[model samples]
Target: MRIELVKGVNLNIIPSKQFKTTRIFISFIKSIESKKELAERALLANYLEMCSQNYPTQIDIARKLSQMYGASFGSSVDRRGNYQLINFSIDYIESKYLVGNEDLLSGVIEFLKEIIFNPLKVGENKNFDEETFTRQKNNTIT
Candidate 1:
């Protein structure tokens, strides 16, 4: 099923019983107009993957994922022809597989929301946390 979350953004739901794991992928696509934008997108993707407002550090993210049965989450940037796509993905064990009635799917969705919409920022300033941003920038450079 495909849902238009907004004017240009879409949500696709593919239900399958074949696998014991559930994978969620969110992609941001934009027309490639300049090399600078591509570079910025790449850097932003890396930075977002590392930290968020709620998950302030890599360790925090790791602990959260560990709590969710070792769910794996990541982001990637790709270019296809004239368009560039930044994809954030997470794979987790289905709720039915858990021992209790834990709603892992809801937790996963909340985590994704935190990563995408609530990024870590410098205090009272409209900028990314400098340490995280600099690390990501250096990693991208090297």
Candidate 2:
């Protein structure tokens, strides 16, 4: 099922009972512009995946995931024809499978929202955290 949330934004759902996990994907697609822009997108994916204002470090993010029944969230960049896509995905075990029957779907969604929309900023400027920026830049380079 697919629904258009706005003019160009959409929400898609594909349900399956075969797997014990649920996956949510969000993507940003745009026409390929330049090599520099591609590099920036790659760096952005890395930075977004690693940290946020609420989860300040990789360790903090990992701990949160661990608490969420071993769920994992990540981001990546892909090229499709003339378009470049930056994708964010999260996969977690279904709440029904938990021993306590706890529902984690809402929590998972909130966590992703935090990572994507509440990134750690550097001071009052419109820049990503300096330490995280440098680290992700180096990681993307290698």
TM-score of each: 0.91, 0.89
Residue pairs with backbone overlap in model 1: none
Candidate 1: stretches off by over 4 Å = 1-10
* lDDT to native, each model: 0.89, 0.87
Q: How would you encode candidate 1's per-residue C-alpha lDDT over 20-128 as one tens digit per residue?
A: 8888899998998999999999999999999998999999999999999999999999999999999999999887888885778768877987988789987776689
Q: For model 2, give the 10-residue run with minimal summed lDDT.
A: 2-11
Error of 1 at 122 (Å): 1.4
In model 1, the number of clashes is: 0
RMSD of each: 1.9, 2.2
| Tens-place lDDT digits, model 2, residues 21-89 | 989899999897899998998888899898898998999999999999899888989999888999999
